[model samples]
Target: MLFDKKGLDNQTLLNLYSNMLKPRLIEEKMLILLRQGKVSKWFSGIGQEAISVGVTMALKNDEYILPMHRNLGVFTTRDIPLNRLFGQWQGKASGFTKGRDRSFHFGTQDYHIVGMISHLGPQLGVADGIALANILNNKNEVTAVFTGEGGTSEGDFHEALNVASVWQLPVIFCIENNGYGLSTPTSEQYHCKDLADRGKGYGMEAFVLDGNDIIEVYTKVKKLAESIRKRPRPILIEFKTFRMRGHEEASGTKYVPEKLMAEWELKDPLISFKNYLLKEKVLTPEKDQALTIKIKEEIDVALEQANAEQPIIPDRSVELSDVYKTFEYQHIESNSKAEEIRFIDAISQGLKQSMQQHKNLVIMGQDIAEYGGVFKITEGFVKEFGKERVRNTPICESAIVEAAMGLSIAGIKSVVEMQFADFVSSGFNPIVNYLAKSHYRWNQNADVVVRMPCGGGVAAGPFHSQTNEAWFTKTPGLKVVYPAFPYDAKGLLATAINDPNPVLYFEHKALYRSIRQEVPIDYFTIPFGKASLIKEGKDVTIITYGSGVHWALETLANNEDIKADLIDLRTLQPLDTESIYNSVKKTGRAIIVQEDSLFGGIASDISALIMEDCFEFLDAPVKRVASMETPIPFINQLEQQYLAKGRFEEELKNLIAY
Candidate 1:
């Protein structure tokens, strides 16, 4: 009522009160519809409806919104069609999600609502991304992300806030602290009494408010939205509310004691505000009754319409709709074609070709723009491609990745450079939660590539030199490509661009200048989930990839009589299982090799798969040759002792003797 942005009239406040009431009715009506079997799932704002609605009211219509499961009030106020909303709940064809997606994957660009995934967290990354996109496009729009107090516990929440604050992104992180995270209270989640306090840890502004009060929410959100528009920066606003209903429609108040429920019911947000309005004479009984009745009627009509609608008949073709934004394929003539270009040179050419091929391609990260990246792996690029295409960024790893995720959604292929492999933890949120799962959430893949300079022998210390493949090798919906030579680097990077999943193309910082092999003359992309044959022999199988492939090749050459078949598993996630199986069965003996720690790395994953599928064919125990279980040290002497490759001379001799 105090704000003039919408010029508060008694009637206007009454209308907002009406809008707030409608969400409650909608939530109730939808629950009834769910029991009637019209919808599959339902999560109501209930006591917290005012916050969702009021926060949205403070925001610009053009600004993007990323919401959680209980954001019906936000969507309703944003003017998202009720039928489409019901369709999403019912998994109907009329929904933007094509009916096959999850119950919470709601999106409508028409309403400026991005995707509202029901999972407890992950929207923070989305909010950061949308805001970054607006910044890049010169569009001054704030992207608001809605979450609960419990979501603050997720690593994504911390990482997103850290990066958004660093970049000064126009993102408003709104946390609805409704006292309980599925019966585990806030006290169980964190020591700080308020969730907003965590925002200060990331060096961002924080606000705490009484969520039940709509007027307060409107005032706070309006001021924050204005401040972010003028000078962009991330801020966390914690709304202290209570979850009046059960976690879901199924659970009764079995977990919540009767006395507490009754005690909280007396302070019911709806009844409390209605009384306040009546006392102030702003809401006459006649007006209040009419407004309540009017909202109930509208919801009744929507429910009736929703019930009358036919169930969605899914077209199988719609299943693959928007699986990938773009795809390309090419073939090279022969092995000689690959023998013509140097490894780093091939990568440079592939990056350039991919950039020239697609107008939406953009490369970023530390030193990638002007210096052509830290290792000069991206050399000659800034000059040939221009600064916009190849960009330099601050040492903020999280910012580089967060920016990439935003661009990927905006139809830009964001190619990021991680100066070192071990330092990627700074950007892990965008990797695991955002890029990897973005497709699964919205039915769309992020076509971004994170070029990580990995592995050791350069004696660059623990922070700068190391192979951390296990960090993401097993994460779903992500392509992990480790290229050993120039041809594979060029071909795989090109293929990774065409793949639907996000890719972490691990480039050896040591091999950036050392490894020299001729790349093909023409543009060509290799197929993923396929292994490359480095050498053909049948006595033993050395299954490896990236830097370890060279070691395996050398070991085979040193002992020619071993007749080992060296297979390079170029792609880790969609792993070339058939190739490994065939080699293991043919040789009747196998050894897994990797540059990373033996524990929990690729060797373990490969060994498990072989045991599951090829145990019957094995003649002996499958061996694993990996670096010792120690950190890649700073000193070369200590590092060398720990850096045992798959094809080390002593390991090869020991295996042969066995």
Candidate 2:
């Protein structure tokens, strides 16, 4: 078949050819380097170059594209410096991630490209978030996200597609059916005849196209992008293609049949496109040879420049620098009159104030818009701040968290609320793998806060009542804020919202209406790593957080002769170890209390810290009071036995008597 070249000019056709050719040539060179032990790995995009080039060239420069590992053409089409890209592959300091990551694992804001994490499907939700931002800003920009057919089976894929369709977001899902996902064939991946057919189930428009035909891909995608921009709705396009090479250089194609490889080889995108250009007299044979030589020379120069750059060295200071954005601790003093408010109301007021202060802030959760959430914390928020800001998301935790991450990438801060703290398990991947590692991986600040209604005392059983603060505190690049009192809850939440990093804000479900304090009406922020001293004494030091703080205060009140200094650790990640040590040293005895199970909770870590640092100053062995290592029971009597409250007072007395 000869080329039509109807809507495209000769120059435009030739430019598309050039874009397709660049990545194919670069990939060949990279494979050579991989075999020669110069490059670590290569995910070849030899036959699928058309999809990358076609999709990238179809979109505008400002429209964001979330691409996979094989989309090298996305970088070249955006005119990303070849030297810096090569530097990235070689793990040099001049790389986009400054040698923190390799290959296409890092995103560059300059190119409007959101890099794919290894878990391919989460980026789909990210695309929805970007499109949502575009809609909120009243812009017609669309977001295009790419994934392989194997990725379509992931939960995130279904969740993102459903959410995008429900919200009427302007997004184009480009699923490259590249025949295989790593070693698994499409036959083993899904039951659908075509990946695009899944779009119909999600209530979106669908298309199937020949990915090997560059002209067909380019023309169709350009038209689809324009249509989506005007209509502002999601569209799914499955590009039926094949990966001519192994998943990577190390994984050979022994699993693929020779006949299948031969069939795909004849339909090679670069070769077929070049033949069409020659047949139409759009490109001469002599000109094609010159263009190939030019691209090879360009790759050689880029390799030379990248080779001259110094590789990253392992320095402690340099390695620890970009884990999280540097935050300054400031204690704001307010002279406003105090009003008594419950813990839940304090958090509500703080969130309301933050929304008023930061216009770009968005809050999303289940039943949050009209129903005002399950707890009534966000009651009347939709009426005040519109549906765009106070969104009610589907019961898809993974998609909403990844969407919040996307919002952060688009310079918008987002707050994600888990209906209960135990439900965080569904959204743990994006929080720990993507959101927590975004800054360290690519200097992308994930300005998002995940609010968790945690803890036990209301007999809500295992699923609803569990103190899971340790889940995020152990994960680096995340801040964990757990407060007990109304004043601290309001102050710490405001600080978490303002921090330019991912934060896990744990609110005790039992303390929502149980605890009240005279809190200032105005907004204020408490320092993250500072501990609050409830009372001072010289006999013993009690360390606690969340619900344990109240138990400690009650014990001190009942036994005035115990003479204890009570310390409340407001934030668990930037734990106020200074205050803890000072209090422990002065009192000469320490007791760490927590509501979580006793085996591997935060109390164990605190007890160890006190043992190591306050060893000489201790007058008695450090004691830890925590719940029994059992699942939270449904019965009130069994639940009370499972909690630390049952034994905390006795434990404190035993420690004092020692």
Candidate 3:
């Protein structure tokens, strides 16, 4: 053999060859299924089998793996049962995602593998979170993550590498340089001679591997994996290979050059390994034929079983059941002697209490360490809980969120603070795609809370001030909580921390210091989907939340004769529709006030809700008073005019008169 195999026995080498052959044969059958119109799509990693098998051979069962769509051999090598795998591909109930997804979009915790989403590069950062969790748990288990050469161009690639290096995390980033990304060649994707060369810039050890040689790939990755567990530093391996097939069955190989395709076909990893095994006399021709027959029979049975199994019947109840953990109302007792505190202090106390209550809770954000935060919401937290728990990440929003998803998957509750709510646009993909859809798609619990300090009126222009809760409210799997008063902010944040799904907690920046109220000293949680009736009246109902609640209250105080009922919607998603309908039914008129822009905002939806549910009871058209559709201005006068507050009195009067 060209590569060292001093410790590997003959049986081990035979098993490695078997593992490499399995995925190649399985995917080949899958391609046939695709052609036969039984399967939707097929993405084959035919030539890259050696790297996937070799890497899997080095991995311990307890170690974590975040695999890309192309690494089927990794699953085979890890002893993932063929029946269940085929079940996943066929969208059966026995599949990992229970027909929610197909083709590598699912994973099971039992296997310690995270099945990747369609979007690439984000999983690499998530792997670092797994590594970080392992370190915290003192398991010293290495996490191996895969991506393509094309994925290196993604910003998440660099962010993941930087965090892994800075924290000395035990993660192996394997890049399969398969020569093409869908149709775009590597030449167009990058100028770097080797993708591993980029890893050096991140202050990590990197090396190249001949991806077709199973012996070399296994030996090198095994050594690297062992060293990583001991020292806990990131390592990058660039596996040079070729894509024997097109990106997927739908994409023909027309774009691939005939010469290049022929050359790679000649160097097919399976064929090369078969020749090596024959040359080494590991098996006679008759025995090889017997092994091949056995594998073919196994594949035939798996295929037959998968075809016979009933597909998961699509049900709306399954889709809605896992969005949030259903819990009976606990009815937390109120503290009559509670101390008065500002909104920011209430938030800090909530975080402190949550961290104290749950040892697994981790808080992360920029400038949240010794600097507390830009808003000081996390001030003195590092000192109280230690830096490991209260981490200050780099200015990478996507990685911050992606890491939270990883940590959550690793059985840790993560609370991420977005320095400015407007900055959430940068990390919107993970929040909307991964965290928000995890439970609904695969029943994966993403216990993450993203603290967004939102809204305007402090003269902070567009970039720093934004009410982005509306954007997330439209998403299905996420819970949106926007608190107006200190009592709700503290209680709802605690609830968000305890919830098993992703919650976007929007704290109004304008109310951080403006409002002060007595909050329960003990750790308490407010029930989700419940609105608070701040003031009771019979004439008109003002439905508002966050800073808009304060504005509505002020407007009502000035116009006491209006006899308005002010309802603060503490949670945007899982909105208290019953409370809204009840209030509007009594008052016969309703006004929805919001700090978000008027166009397609939450206020518009609430207004529509009232019109639909309470139309018969209403005396006038459902009114929506929100900020102008235009961006907030830099000038103080124009900024005030741009806000919902500027039109509050006028809109309130119009609604009352109507």
Q: Best candidate per TM-score, number?
A: 2
- Per-residue lDDT value at 150 in model 1: 82
User: Where is the poorest 10-residue window by lDDT in model 3?
Assistant: 327-336
Clashing pairs in 1: 339-518, 340-518, 341-517, 341-518, 341-519, 439-444
For every candidate in turn, the CA RMSD to the true structure comes to 5.3, 1.1, 1.4
Tens digit of per-residue lDDT, candidate 2, span 1-658: 3455757999988999999999999988888898799999888888999899999999999999999998999989999989999999999988888887889998999999999999998899999898999988899898999999989999999999999999999999999999998999999999889999999999999999988888888899999899888899999999999999899878989999999999999999888889988988999999999999999999999999999987688888866878998877666766899899999999999999889979999999999898999999999999999999999999999999999998998989999999999999999999999899999999998999999999999989999999988888888899999999999999999899999899999999999999999999998888898899988999999999999999988888888888888999999988999999999999999999999998888888999999999899998999999998898998999998899998999988888889
Q: Model 3, 1-658: lDDT tens per residue?
A: 2545557788988988888888888888888888898888788888999998999889898888889889999788888888899888888877887787889988778888888888897888889888889888888789999999999999989999999898889999999999999999999999989999998899999999999889889888999899887888899999999998889877878999999999988788888778778887875688778888888899999888889998677788876786765545565655656999999999999999999989999999999999999988788888889999999999888988998998988899999999999999989988998898887667787889999988898888989888888789999889999998898998888888888889999988888998999887888888999999989999899999988888888887888788888999999988999999999999999998988888889988898888887899999988888998898877789889999898989988887787
The pairs that clash in candidate 2 are none
What residue runs in model 2 are displaced by over 4 Å at the alpha carbon? 1-3, 329-331
lDDT of each: 0.76, 0.92, 0.88
Clashes of each: 6, 0, 0
TM-score per candidate, chains pooled: 0.78, 0.99, 0.98
Error of 3 at 611 (Å): 2.0
